[model samples]
Target: MHDWLDEEDDALITTALELMEEQRKEQNKTAARGQRAPGAGGPQYSG
Candidate 1:
């Protein structure tokens, strides 16, 4: 039972990491383009 739970947790963590990396790449692209217009809110991110 515990082993199954561990495997599940690992899978979830791996998925999350992949998603975060993709997000970082996207953010970099947007940043290279330039900042958003005033009052036009964009994605809020954290490291």
Candidate 2:
């Protein structure tokens, strides 16, 4: 039972890490595309 739990925990961790990495890649692609477009909105600073 302990071994099975360990395996499940590892699988969950791996999946979470993979999802985070995919999100990072998508964010980078979006930023790059925004940079290429004309008149992209300037950064808004909130105090």
Candidate 3:
């Protein structure tokens, strides 16, 4: 645990957190758009 983080350190941490949040939002959007049923397969098991 760090008791004291300078202004520069704090700013970098804040910016990184914000960037991660944005990337997560973008990924969620992409996943939501791809929730359709899967395509048919050739064969699962052939006896």
Candidate 3 displacement at residue 43 in angstroms: 22
Q: Evaluate residue 46 in candidate 3 and report its C-alpha lDDT on the 0 to 100 scale.
A: 21
Query: Could you tally the backbone clashes for each prediction?
Result: 0, 0, 0
TM-score of 3: 0.61
lDDT of each: 0.72, 0.72, 0.62
Which lDDT tens digits does candidate 1 get at residues 1-47?
A: 47999999999999999999998888776665544553233553434
Error of 1 at 9 (Å): 0.4
Residue-wise C-alpha lDDT for candidate 3, range 15-43, written one tens digit per residue: 99999999877756555555442223222
**Candidate 2 local distance difference test against the native:** 0.72
| Model 1 stretches astray by more than 4 angstroms | 35-47
Return the lDDT, model 1, position 10.
97
- RMSDs, each prediction? 3.3, 5.0, 9.9
lDDT of 2 by residue, 1-47 (tens): 48999999999999999999998777666666666773463442222
C-alpha lDDT of residue 8 in model 2: 94
Give the number of the best model, judged by TM-score: 1
